[model samples]
Structures are given as C-alpha cells and as structure tokens.
Target chain A: DTAVSQTPKYLVTQMGNDKSIKCEQNLGHDTMYWYKQDSKKFLKIMFSYNNKELIINETVPNRFSPKSPDKAHLNLHINSLELGDSAVYFCASSWTGATNEKLFFGSGTQLSVL
Target chain B: GESVGLHLPTLSVQEGDNSIINCAYSNSASDYFIWYKQESGKGPQFIIDIRSNMDKRQGQRVTVLLNKTVKHLSLQIAATQPGDSAVYFCAETYHLIYNQGGKLIFGQGTELSVKP
Candidate 1:
C-alpha cells in the first residue's frame, strides 16, 4: 500500500484559476506537512499540521491555504493562482512532530500555471 | 537569514566510485540533520540522519559526517551505482520551543550522476 498519496499527479491551469490538491496518508502518523519545490529543485516547507492543528506556516502568499480535516488528510487549496505558483507540491507525514523523526513523502503533484 | 547550501550543484562519478556531497549551514543552533534523496519526477526520500551530539552515522551505503565547529555536513556514498543517480539534499532542523515540531531547512541540493 502507498504510505502517502496525492491526487492529480500533474496540473496545468491558466493564471487566476483556482485549484485544489488532495493528500492522504495511511502511515497513521500524527504530523503532516506540505512542501513546494521550485524549478531550481529547492524544497521549502509551506505549512504543517500536527493532529489537525496548524503548526508551521511559512511566508507563503494568502492565495495558498491548507486544511486538515483529520490527521490522515491534509488538503491544499489555492485561490486565484498566479504564474509564480508553478511548482511541484509534496505531502509528507511523520510519526510525530519531533525533528528526529523521519518523514515519509508522497510522489508529489506538479502544478503549472500559464 | 540562516540557510543550508551545498558546495557543488552537480557531481559526476563513475560506477563503483565513491562520491561525497558537501553542505554548509549557517545556523549554529541546528542540532539535528538529515539527508534526503530525490529522484526525477518523485518526492524527496529520507536516506539517513545524524544529530548534533554525534559526529558520524552510517547507513547501508551512505555515511553522514557532521562538524559542529564549522557547521558543515557531508554525505558520502560508497560504490556509486546507476540507481544512485539523484539529487541529494541536506536539511537542518531547529526545534521550536513554543511549537512541538521543528523547522527543517533544506539545502540547494547536489545532483549526483553515476556513469557506467
């Protein structure tokens, strides 16, 4: 079984169009995270939720919002996406929120805004 | 603006040769470090990790070395293989006192190409 899975492996949309990506993990982990990888392959953390509580929120734009209905699901919703939103989004989960815990990542969703 | 960066953006090595990727971190307070391997069209996978209390940690074919004085870390791969061709990233974690989780800062990443 896939530990972490995200839907819509690839997404192509025009600017100002809104889109949403869904993420789910069967690892039974308490913490989940959303990361964005740019064209340069630089991965940056965007948001994190621990047991359905918002824990980490980076300097991302207001267009990006993350909602976690439960610990096993964390979904990303982008409003009025811009060209700069083109990047690969990844979903990750860990047993706990501790730094020592290793994170299991999903395949990732490639988003392209034209 | 503390960040983790790599010395080289790309490294090419012959199969069966040893490969070393270097990373430098500016945050002295970072006590935990991890190495992740990312293949083309895939997300980053955990390879190995080392803590500030330890100088070195060894995995199956990977070794991580940490230098607290210079705030430097390195990942050494033994007997590089074609399957090892991927972008390697080094991340430093700083624990947040108020929050339960730690903030992981990733390096620019080094692409390793193994030629047979």
Candidate 2:
C-alpha cells in the first residue's frame, strides 16, 4: 500500500489560472506537511497541518493556500498562478510531532505554469 | 534559523565503491537528523536517521555520522550501486510543538551519481 499519495502526478496550466493539488496519507500520522521543490531542487516547507489544524506557515505568497478537510487529507489551492510557480509539490506525513519521527513522502506533483 | 545545509551539490562515485555526503547545521536545539534520497520526477525517500544522543547510526548499507561539536553530519554508503544515484538531502528535525513530529529543515540536495 502506498503510505502517502498525491493526485494529478502532472499538472500543466496557463498563467493566472487556478489549480489545486490533493494529498492523502494512510499512515495514521497526525502531522502532514506541504513542500515545494524548486528547479534548484531546494525543498522548502510551505505549510503544515496537524490534525486538520494549521501549524506552520512559511514565507509563501498569499496566492498559495493550504486547506485540510480532515486529519488525513491536505490540499493546496493556488490562485492566479504565475510562471514562477512551476515546480514540484510534495506531501509528507509523520507518525508523531517529536523531532525523531521519520517522514513518509508522496511521489509528488509536477506543476508547470506557462 | 537555517537548520540544515550540505557542503556539495554533486558527488560522483564508481560502482562498487563507497560514498560519503556531508552536511552542516546550525540548530543546536535540533535533536534528530535524517537523510532522504530523491530521483528525477519523484519525491524524497527516507533513508536513515540519527538522534543527537548517538554520533553514529547504521542501516542496511547506509551509515550516518553526526558531530555535535562542529554541527556536522555525514552519510556513508557501502558498495554504492547504480540504484543509489539520486539527489540526497540531509534534514534536521526542528521541534516547534509538543507531542508531534517536528518540522524537517532540508538542505540543498546533493546529486549522487554512481558510474559503472
């Protein structure tokens, strides 16, 4: 079974369009996070949701919003996307909130804003 | 604070040889560290992790070493194979809350290529 999964492995959209990426985890983890991997392959945390509660909000633009409908699902909604929004988005889950828990990540969705 | 960082952006190794990837971090409060491997068109995969209490930890073919004095960490792979070729990242566990998984601060990845 896939521990962590994300929908729409590839997304291609024009600039100023709106899009959303869905993520789910069956690992029974309480903490879930959204990360953006840029062209340079630098993984940056955008948001983290713990038990459907927003916890960490990085320096991301307001156009990017993350919504958690439940403890097991977190979705990202992008508004008026720009060309620079093209990158890989990843969903991750961990068993606990401690510093020692290992994270399981999904395959990722490649978003291309043209 | 920027918690995790790597020393190199790429590392080339020969088949059947060993490989070592280095990282530096600044969070003294961080007590856990993990290494992840990511390939093209894929998300990051967890390799191994070590807690602050231990300086060294081992897995199947991977070994992680941590130096708290210099705030450095390294991952050593034995008999590196082609399948090991990927971008490796060192992540620090930054605790922000109680009774939860800490946030992972990932460093700039290092692409490892095992040439035959």
Candidate 3:
C-alpha cells in the first residue's frame, strides 16, 4: 500500500489558469507539508498543516492556498498560475513532533505552467 | 527569503568510490538538519539527519556531519552505486513554535552521477 499519494501526476496549463492538487496519507500522521522544487531543484516549504491547523505558512503569495478537509488529506489550490510556478510539488507526512521524524513523500505532482 | 544555496552544482563519482556532498547554511539558529535524496521523477527521500547537539550521525550507508562553528554540513556516501545517482539536497529545520516557526530550508541541490 502506498503510504502517501498525490493526484494528477502531471499538469500542463497556461498562465491564469486555476488548478488544484490533492494529497492524502494513510500513515496516520498528524503533520502534513507541501514543498515545491523549482527548476534549480531548490525545494521550499509552501505550507504545513498539523491536524487540520495551519501551522507553517511561508512567504508564498496569497494566490496559493492549502485546504485540509481532514487530517488524512491536504489539497493545494493555485489561482492565476504564473510561469515561475512551474515545478514539482510534493506532499509529505510525519508521525510525531520529534525533530528527527522523517517525512514520507508522495510521488509528486509536476505542474508546468505555460 | 531563500537560504543561500550550494557552491558546487554537480558531482560525479565512479562506482564503488566514496562521494562527499557539501552545504553551507547561513542560519546559526538551525538545530536540526537532514539529508534528502531525490531521484529523477520522485520526491526527496530522507537519507539521514543530525542535530546541533551531535556533530555526526550515521545510517546504513550514509553519514551526515555537522560543524557549528562554520555552519556547514556534509553528506558522505559509502561505495557509491549506479542506483545512487540522483540529486542530493541538504535541508535544515530551525526553532520556533512546535510546528509554526518550523520550516525545512533546502539547498539548491547537487547532482550525483555515479558512473558504472
């Protein structure tokens, strides 16, 4: 069984398009996170939710929002996508609050904004 | 703001050789560090991690070394294999709210080409 899974393995859209990526984890984790890997392969945290509570919100624009319907699911919505938004977005989950807890990653959603 | 990234962008090593990937972090407050490996089309996978209190941590075939004075970290791979060819990223976590102030800042990443 896949521990973490994300929808739309690949997405190709033009600028100004609004889209959403869904993520789910069966690891029964309380913490979930979103990360983006750019062309430079620089992975940055976009947002994180712990048990449905918005925890870490990076300087990402307001156009991008994350919604967690429940602790098992966290979805990302991007409005007015821009060229710079092209990259692979990853969803991750951890078991506990320990700093050493490794995040189990999803296969990732490759969003390419034309 | 983004963390200052890597100085070396790519590295290649012969199979069975040891590989060392280096990173420099600007934040002195960062206490927790992790090494992540990302293959061509997959998410970054955790390799090993070390805390500020400990200078070194070793896993099955990977080792992470941290230097507080220089704010530097390195990931050493033992007996590199073709399967090990991927992009290696160094990430750090800092102190703050249990989860709010916490963020994993990733390096630009170094491409590891394990030649067979």
For each candidate in turn, give its C-alpha RMSD to the true structure in angstroms. Answer: 2.4, 2.8, 2.6
Estimate, for each residue in B1-116, the C-alpha lDDT of model 1 and write its tens digit.
12335343889999999999999876999999999999998889999999999999999999999999988899999999999999999999987887757678988899999999
Give the i-RMS of model 2 in Å.
Answer: 3.3
For candidate 2, report its TM-score: 0.92
Once fitted onto the true fold, the runs of candidate 3 whose alpha carbons sit more than 4 angstroms away are: B1-8, B98-101
lDDT agreement with native, every candidate: 0.92, 0.88, 0.88
DockQ head-to-head 1 vs 3, winner: 1
Q: lDDT tens string, model 3, A1-114?
A: 989999999999999999999999999999899999777877888988888988888899999999999999999999999998999999999875345667889999999999
Name the runs in model 2 displaced over 4 angstroms: B1-8, B97-101
Flag the better candidate by TM-score, 1 or 3.
Answer: 1
lDDT of candidate 2 over A24-109, digit per residue (tens): 99988988999998888889988888898887898899999999999899999999999999999999988754567777889999
Ranking by DockQ: 1, 3, 2
**Candidate 3: residue pairs that collide:** none
Candidate 2 at residue A82, lDDT?
99
List chain A TM-scores, every candidate, in order: 0.99, 0.97, 0.97
State in Å the error of residue B19, model 1: 0.4
